[model samples]
Target: MSAEIVVLLVVFVGLLILNVPVAVAIGVSALAMIATLGHVPTAFLMAERMSNGINSFPLLAIPFFVLSGVLMGQGGMARRLMDFAAAMVGRLPGGLAYVNTLSCMLFGAVSGSAAAAVSSIGGFMIPQMKEKGYSKEFAVALTATSATTGLLIPPSNIMIVYAVVSGGVSVAGLFMAGVVPGMLIGFLLMVASAVLMRVGGHSKAGVAQVPRFWPAFFGALPSLLLIFIVLGGILGGVFSPTEASAIAVAYAVVLGGFFYRQLGWADVPKILLIAAKTTSVVMLLIGASQAMSWVLTYENIPQMVSEAMLTLSANPLMVFLLINVLLLLVGTFMDMTPAVLIFTPIFLPVVVELGMHPVHFGIMMIANLCIGLCTPPVGTCLFVGCSVGGTTIARTTLPAIPFFLAMLVGLLLVTYVPWFSMALPGWLNLF
Candidate 1:
């Protein structure tokens, strides 16, 4: 690596180790590297890059999506989905576990925020699971791991960020691409839960006494309709993903505030405030990551990194494996948004050279990072889940082992089997 690159890494990693905010670490690191190069005024150039970073029309979707998630979560969408899920699978052996998995997947489909799912669904499921004789560790671990499926399902704000940074890869196509892999991850997590139940002697403990399926489904149907509206609107060309996000906010307001009546008019300010805070953090991360990307591109870091990886292995599978391993480690410490923003520019080229579709790579990368959300140190979902469940990370991590393996299995399948990620988008002519 060049001296400038060394300086950037040292500074960035040091700041992160010191618990600095990720956006600040990235901006400072990028600015430091630019200062070393002495080619231009670092502050002026970085300001321009930061301004340009969040200047896209596509990024408007994030705040709306965040708002919608908060609104739905506040209204009782999680409970309705849980009720519907219980009605669907609550009679199976170890049914509460399955209900937890399915409810997270369903909630993820609508809200597209893993942390929101963790907080909403985990709060309810963790206590219920504990009451039903499941361990607190198991409950929190399951909730944290399964919630990541939302990122892979539609209306994902991270996908929007990817589409923006990826320089015109279709948002619709990326949305379509995530469907199967997301479900696959959910299925594998379910399988792992079932296996844990059997091995741990908890198999018959989780049967729930839920209402009839049709009634539960009908009750939850209004909230569920957001999925079809946002995704269908995008796929049908009635609107862009940004417009669909705005529509999702409107629908969430109507469903949560009017139909459900769980979210009172008095709740509006708090929801907006929460959404604004979340959006501000994400937007600042994007802006800083953009400056970092500019520094990387200006220094030809992408080419250098790509060439280095290719030189290590010319075989596509091996190169891809190396990339996955690196990303998995990155995910362990970095939050998903900054990780995606900083790494996409670095690795997209390597995958493209191997003849991988950008849509496929996008899904693969997101799936890989989804696992990170449940890990320690910087796992956002893990922290939220632990908080909701009233457990510690150390307590949850051991129980999370099986689900982690399950997620790894899902990630590998997504990595090797192009069809899993590609088939739906292909069938829809999205590419």
Candidate 2:
């Protein structure tokens, strides 16, 4: 670690401990480093880097995706997806758990926002699970953990962020690459929940009643089609990812307003305001992280850190393990957007040097960070899920353990097994 890196870490950590907002903490730390080094005036560097940070065309996809998620989430999509999931698995032993997991996965696939998934699916499933006799902590844990699979699924805002920061990894390829790994994690979560429920002595009495398969499927069909419209257009080269994002927003409006009749013109202002707020926060984080990345690069921090990690281990597996561990720790403390922004530039060079494909590493990195969203201190989904379930972090921590372990297991597989991340994109010739 260089003196500059030490200063950056100290200031950043100190600000975090003082309860400053994450974006502010990052920007302040970057500014402090510039002042300490006296290499460049703080204002000029901050202005240039921060403005350049959010100047990319690809970033436009983020706001569109966020708006679309808000639209679909409020459009009665969650209940219909729940019905469809229940129709698929609600009669199995410990069915409500399966329903919650499956519904979250479906909602995530369409909505492409993990927080939206947690709020929408958790809002419904947590209460339903409690009524079915599942513990509140377990319900929050399950909802929070399962919701993160969305970030791994297609049309993800975080994937757009990664695509931009990664320099040139195809957005469509990243989207395709994530499909199997995302589903794999969701399946692992479902199995973990089912097995834990069985071990905890939940009887068959908790099984839920679902509507007929055809009705449920047809009801959710409009919401489901948005997935194909957005992903298919991008993959087919009918549009770029940014164009696809706009199309997704259009589709979401049509589905929510006309097709479903759940969303009205009266609801547009609130949805836009919510989307604007989310987008502003995310863009600010990107700008701040960009400044941080620039400072790190100017100080040669990435090269130094990369060299240190490579010195620690010449073996690819060991180096990857070291990176994954660091990312997991970073995830616990930082939000995913800024983490992806700041670390992608630093760690990507090392992985490319090791011969790992950028798309594979992107999936691996996102999957690894998803676990952090369910952990403590700054786990976004954890806090949201707990609030939705009317529970506290302290109460939810124990029950969340198994699912956390399950995500860790999935992350290990994603890290070590290239096939899970590479198969789909390769088949599509997406590279």
Candidate 3:
């Protein structure tokens, strides 16, 4: 490696080790490399790249989606969804566990944020489950693992970010590709939860008393309508992803603030403020990561890395195995958004060269990282789940083992079975 490239890696890794902000670590490291190479003036090039990074029209979706999630979460939507999920699954053996899993899938799909799922679903379900005699560890582990389904489901902010970083690959296609895999993961987690319940002899201990389906369904219908309006419109070609996201904001407001009458004018400003702060962090990370990506590309780092990966194995299965293992480790330390921004550019080329579809690869990357969301060190969902479940990290990790294995199995299924991701997009002829 060139001295300049070595300096970039060293500085970036060093900053991350020192616990600096991810955006600062990326921007400072890139600037240091630019100065070391003595090319263009560091300030001018860095400024140019940073501005250019967030200039895309599609980037607007992040804020709208985030605002919608905040609105839905703060109003009565979470409780309504919980009631609906309970009605749907409450009669089964280990009913509360199924409700927890299904609620996370539903709530996560609507909000497009696993953090929201963990906080919202876990807040209610964990206490209820504990009252029903389930262990605190089991409640937290299941909630944390199931919440990650949001990342794989439609209307996902992470997928929007992936589409932007992959140079305008279809957001619609990526959304289509995620559905089956996301549903599959939800089912696997439910199965694990059911098994855990049977082993603990809690199968019949706390059966939920569900209301009539019609009553609960009608109660939750308004909040549920938001999903159909947004995703159905996108799939039907009625609106672009960004337009759907904008409509989601309006719908969430009307449903939460007006029709439900749960949220008032007083709540609007707080929601907007939170959304703005989150958007700022996400946008800054994108810009900084883009600047670093450009520097690496100019230095031929992507090409070199791609060549090295191919030399490891010409076999497709072995190549993906190695890639999945690498991404799993990467998830341990990095948060999802910055990880996607930084690593997508690096690995996209390698996978495409191996004749893998970018859409499939995007889903694969998100699925692998979903496991990390429940892992320790820096997992956001992990923190939220533990906090809400009233358990410590060490207490939750052991119970989380079975669910994590279920996630790995789902990841492999998505990775190896192209149809798991590709079928919907193909039926829609999206590619």
* Candidate maximizing lDDT: 1
lDDT of 2 by residue, 216-275 (tens): 999989888888888888877799999999999998998889988989989999999999
Which residue pairs collide in model 3, if any?
none
Worst 10 residues of 3 by lDDT: 204-213
lDDT (CA) per prediction: 0.92, 0.90, 0.90
Residue-by-residue lDDT tens digits, candidate 3, 1-431: 89989999899999999999988999999999988878688899999999999998899989999999998888788888888999998888789999999889989988888999999999999999999999999999999999999788888999999999999889999988998999999999988887888999988854457867898899888877887888789889899888999999999888887888888888778888999999999999999999999999989988988999999988889989998999999999988888899889988999999999999999999999998888999888989998887789998899999999999999999999999999999999899
lDDT of 2 at 65: 91
- Residue-level error in angstroms, candidate 1, position 384: 1.5
TM-score of each: 0.98, 0.97, 0.98
Q: Give the TM-score of candidate 1.
A: 0.98
What are the clashing pairs of model 2?
A: none
lDDT of 1 at 405: 98
Which pairs clash (backbone N, Cα, C closer than 3 Å) in model 1? none
Which residue runs does candidate 1 get wrong by more than 4 Å? none
Residues 290-362 of candidate 1 have per-residue lDDT tens digits of 9999899988999998999999989999989999999999999998999999999999999999989999999
Model 1 lowest lDDT segment of ten: 202-211
